[model samples]
Target: MSALAGVALEHPVMNAAGTCKSVEEVDSFARSAVAAIVVGSITRQPRTGNTGNVYWPGRVYSINALGLPNRGLAYYGEHLPGMVERAHEAGKPLIVSVAGFDVGEYQEIAEVVADAGVDLVELNLACPNVWDGGAQKRIACFDPGQTAAICTAVGDALLARAGGDQAGRVPYGVKISPFSDPAALAELAAVLAELAGRPGGPRFVTAVNTFPNALVVDADHRPVVDVELAGMSGPALKPVGLGQVRQLRRLLPDTVDIVGVGGVGEGRDVAEYLRAGAAAVQAATAFWNRGEDPSVFGSILASWIDAGGIDPVDSAIR
Candidate 1:
């Protein structure tokens, strides 16, 4: 067992947001061995997501722009209460990933998730696939100022829903894109530290959204997917994810937990994340490669336990 953001988890492994988007997918996670149910990087409106050859998977790496396809708020909202109950019955907390077009939408969607009684919320600030005209939409985590604004808004909303005490309220975190530049990473961490000092601050940080704008081409010299570029994941991304987690662990106080993500394909990967000081870890490409089957988690988790994945100072399992 493990704990993330003060919520008890049966294990440290849970599916990443885009890995499971539908009510059925989320419910499958609830019934599976996963420690939590992560639903949506959902938007205020229904999204068909990016279509037409949007995904391509490689042996140890995959790249494609998914465009954050989701059923929108109304569909998930109506089904959320039931999803939460199912998760609770199975001894797991429901964590919703909120993605919005603007700061106000983040607050609004988060309020609905908190009201539905989710145990945790993660604001997705690093989606690199949403295209507007020819360029991608602004990624929230890149700018410290905007990141602070979004976090402040969402925090205030969640705190208010809890009647001003975060103790009984839904805790929150941010899923940030991977950083290749030390100075940039430090800048964001400083902003996050400042936020962490506040009452409505982040309870945890999920590191390393896929490396953005990666384009894969086949032997035929054509783009692997329909889009020119997409986020990259699989084994190639693990190192970057680990580096981000390690740095965040050192930079952020222990009061703010860290959840590691990237290129995690097996039990050893889980152990690696723990060694890097991740309270928990999430998976996407690994799960996708396993045919969206929950058993993949069981296998990977079994491997982790065999590898002595738990660490007193690093792993969240005490």
Candidate 2:
């Protein structure tokens, strides 16, 4: 079993938050082999976000400005308990993803979810769409100080709100922006390494959240969504994801765990990520297009694991 941020997972494959639904969305997933299931991003207040068809097209990619639409805290709180129970019954780790505009919003949402008994919390510190109200502009999140501030705030909040062994038991981590510059990525990793030395700090990071913007317009040539840019995620993003894993591995301390999520479509993709530095890997878009095939990419990974081709404990930076 692989453990990240104190959550012990039976496998290394996890569904990215917002991409995968609760056990309620795909009934078959309840009994599937996915190590963890990250629920939708929950916010302190409900947000309708930008409406209409927000998904944009690409030759081998797609851009979206969904505005991080969510069911808000109250409803999520009411429904999440049942979701968590169902996931637990099916023997899967439950991770709650939290997002917000600023420190207060992020902290409040995380505290509420932690109280709901999630095994871990994924903080979205670098959501392109949410960063500037659909400006869709691409900005780097490679600044270690900026990255550390956002993560530390959420981490401290989680630790404070969930005091006791229970508090320490639920570890916190952040997701990074996909288009991070090499220097920025190194700086961010350095910051995370520094924070790891603090009394209570984040346990891991899900590097390279999504690929840089690849805006696609509708047939009318008008923007699909109001946002001019959108985050890219799919098979095309795998290489960038691997680069992030390697970069972070080199800069971060050994204690810091990494969960790679970007564009993993096959077992080899997972293997590449693991060899790079990820303790675990998450594939969103590929599985999203595969429909009900829970084993779409997982079967490949299983064979690799069986063959010992993928090592979850390998932390090599390059």
Candidate 3:
């Protein structure tokens, strides 16, 4: 059941990886709706993240510039055990979203958390600037070959960490960044297909992390953040997210599972991602705007599923 490939979540609605904080931070709000709460990205090393305001909400949308600040493996080991216990008390699964500078670091963290007792581990390949050489987000490694190599390296490390036969005991999946070309996506999907065929590799892929960075100038014509551009996410990115998921579904073999995430704000959004062929779905901005209240979207999705509602399908694409 730990195989993320096609495992049914306790609930269809899940909190997006970085959007929600620690269990204690949103416990009351998450009690009702979220079937699972993924703690923020934890790295191999401790990070204080970026300084300055990380969240800037607008009329119908919000902008976030928070650098990925985490307690690292040492702190996560101490903090997450308690969080997982609490989520279990509420009958919710706890997925730990983790990032590492490279493959070795990723496996190291996965092994540590698996030993500590996490239900699933989400390998965040889209984290902003956590890699070496000061590479920024999206631009970290645009070459398809590089992406495939990175994934395969990480996937292999995870398999090794899980020790093959016990791979089923710990689920592993990667959240992919949106790369424009279909050929590039197909190439990356091919790599995943190869790994999926291997002894122990990832079973699922989460598509299109935040949108490519934006250049927004204030009244004084000054740009925000220390970077030249920042990624955009929210309702505005919905269509782009849909397209990426739809394409990945088309490119990936049917055997490979996909988790659709990005610009999801409601049951309808989850339904759309499912329609695009995601085995599971997640959101960040929605939870940010609606708070952690589970019923905010979970009940709505559960109710829709209870009814003989329209099922999203790839056949509908034409």
Candidate 4:
């Protein structure tokens, strides 16, 4: 068994946000051997998402500019209780992934989801496809101040709901951008480290959201994605994501958990993330491309860990 942020997980694998968009998809994951399921990132209102060839799959990696299309928060609020119950029955935690255009929106969504009795909430700060007022907005994770503000707001919101106590409070984490720049990464890590030092602050941080703004072209040399750029995932991202997890693991105190994401396709990939100091790992493209039951991958990972084929360092922060 593995544990994240004080919660025990039957395994260390879970689905990434946006991979499971519908209630049916969430149910499919619950029935699988995945240790947990993170629902698609939900916005304040429903979005139809960007138009034109939004997804392109290749041999090495895949490109997507989905623009966070999802049903609004109200839809999830009404449906999540049942999903949470089903996940509990399957011995898994149902983590709600939330996104917003601004700080208040993030806090509001966090408060609502926390009250819904979901096991965890992930604040999505690194969706590169997000467009506001017909323009691409800056990724939240790139701004350490804004990122910390949002985390503080969400944490305070959850704590307020618990009558200013930490017990029985809902835990929350942030989904960070893939930092290709070491300086930017250290700045963000500093912000997270400070939050981790506070009472009722973020309990965990998920590293390496899909690398943003990849340009893929057609045979005619024209851009393939309608947005001209999209987030890239799959094998190409493993090195960058793994590096980010290693960096964050070294920066944050052991009290904070790290969830590694990006480019994970097999048991060894999961083991690699664990060795990098991730308490758990998440993925989407591998499951999407294979078009098979997610449990198949989870079972492979479980067997690898059980047979002692791979050894993960103790999850405690070193």
Candidate 5:
């Protein structure tokens, strides 16, 4: 078993936010072998998302510009309690993903979701496709100041709702942008380190939300997606994600859980992240390419571990 903060997970695998977006998907996760289920990114108001082609699957990678479509926090406020109860009955924890246009919006949405008994709240600060009032806003994870402000506000709100006891507060984490530059990653790590020093700050950091925007064109010389740039996922992102996990492991204290994400498709990939010092790992494209049954990958990991194919400190050598 792996534990993040005080919550124990049966396994270290779970679905990434936005991969499981519906009641049917939630029910499916409840019955699956994944350790937990993270609901789609939710906003204060419902969103219709972007138009035109939104997803493109490739041999090595996939690109998407889904634009954070969701049914709004009000809908979740009413339904998530029951969903949480059902997930608990299945012996799984239900995590909710919250996204907002600004810090206040993040806090508001997080406060509401916290009251619904969610086991964890993931603040999505690195969505690359969000457009506000017809203009693309800067991804929050790229801005250390903004990231710190949003995390502080949301953490304080959750703590207040928990009545001043840090233990009673629901653990939360940040989904940050991928950084290939060492200096930039160092800056971001400093921000997270500061948050970790806070009395009731984030307990975990989900490394590498998605790589920077990418563009794909078709034979007719037109963009495949309506948007000029989309987020990249799948096998192409594994190396980058692995590097981010390794950097975070070296920089952040062990108290802050690191969730390695991006491009993981098999048990070997999950083991790679674990060896990089991630407490857990998450995958979206793999689930989309492979299927909803998480055990397909979990079983492979189990078999590999039993065979001593993975060593926590040096998985490559093993």
Candidate 6:
């Protein structure tokens, strides 16, 4: 079995957060090949999300500016117990994506989800569409200091579970933006490295959210999607994602897992991330393009198996 952050996955293939938000989607994951079920990047209040055509999947890649649309943390926290049970019943873990607006929000989310018994928390530090009063905000992953503070706050919340200590704190992971500079990655890694072995520290790092500020136009010479620019993903992003994974695998402590995302549409893509040092991988564009069908995961897994399969990453050459 493949594992991430000490949680066993039926395999390394799972859906990216935005792709698995609804209750029906949760059920679909339980019936599919995904290693785990990830619920939100939910906020304190429900968000209507960006309107208009905020998404476009092309021949090689897809672009989206869907915003951080969700039913909010309360909805997620209220239903988390059932979700966790469903995932566990299916022999997988349930990881919630925490999209807090601030460090305090992260703590609040941790308290709620942790109390509800989620297996893992994914701290979303790099969503390009996070807006404040309709104005887009900066992504936190780019600021090392902010990243540390948020992580510490979440850790503190988890600490409450362990009686003022690190032990028993729920392990969390950071979903960060793709970096164009090695310096940026190294900076973030340094922060995460400090928390690598400590309880309540991040135990996994999701290599990318999406390449930000990417624009695509249709034949009319106009922006294809309603948004001026959006986060890009799909086959074209594999190189960037793989490079990030390779760099992260080198930068992070081996004990921390690396989840590779971007441009994964098939099993070969999944294998590519594994070869690039990702312990597991997430597929978003492919799943979306296939209409969010859970079977897409099964097909991806089957394709991976057909490609002669990969030996466990712990034994394979990376």
lDDT of 6 by residue, 1-318 (tens): 678988766678888888877677788899988878788877888987888999998999899898889888878878888888888888888888888888998889878988888888899999987668767889999999999999988887788776876657777889999999899899899999997766677889997898998989888889987877899988888899999999999999988899999987787888889989998998889988998788888888778877856444442322
The TM-score, computed over Cα atoms with residue i paired to residue i, of candidate 4 is: 0.94
CA-RMSD of model 4 = 3.0
Query: How does each model score on TM-score?
Result: 0.95, 0.85, 0.84, 0.94, 0.93, 0.94
Q: What is the lDDT of residue 48 in candidate 6?
A: 79
Order of models, best lDDT first: 1, 4, 6, 5, 2, 3
How much lDDT does each candidate structure score? 0.86, 0.71, 0.66, 0.85, 0.84, 0.85
Which candidate would rank higher by lDDT, 1 or 6? 1
> Quick one: ranking by TM-score, best first?
1, 6, 4, 5, 2, 3
Candidate 3, lDDT over the whole model: 0.66
The TM-score measured for candidate 1 stands at 0.95
Candidate 6 versus truth, CA RMSD in Å, comes to 2.5
Q: After superposition, how far is residue 230 of candidate 4 from its true place, in Å?
A: 0.2
Give me the displacement of residue 59 in model 1, in angstroms: 1.7
What candidate 6 gets wrong by more than 4 Å, as runs, is 164-167, 310-318
Error of 5 at 225 (Å): 1.8
Judge candidate 2 at residue 28 and give its lDDT. 57
Q: After TM-score superposition, what is the CA distance of residue 27 in candidate 5 from its true location, in Å?
A: 0.4
- In candidate 2, which residue pairs clash? none
Candidate 3 stretches greater than 4 Å from native: 1-4, 26-30, 59-61, 129-146, 161-163, 224-228, 291-295, 298-318
Which pairs of residues collide in candidate 6?
Answer: 234-263
lDDT (tens digit, per residue) of candidate 5 on 206-272: 9878676899888997888898699999889989999999999899877799999987777778878
Give the backbone clash total of model 6: 1
**Poorest stretch of ten by lDDT in candidate 2:** 131-140
Which portions of model 2 miss their true places by more than 4 Å? Answer: 21-23, 26-28, 56-59, 131-146, 164-167, 217-228, 292-318
Which structure is stronger by TM-score: 4 or 5? 4
Q: Give the TM-score of candidate 6.
A: 0.94
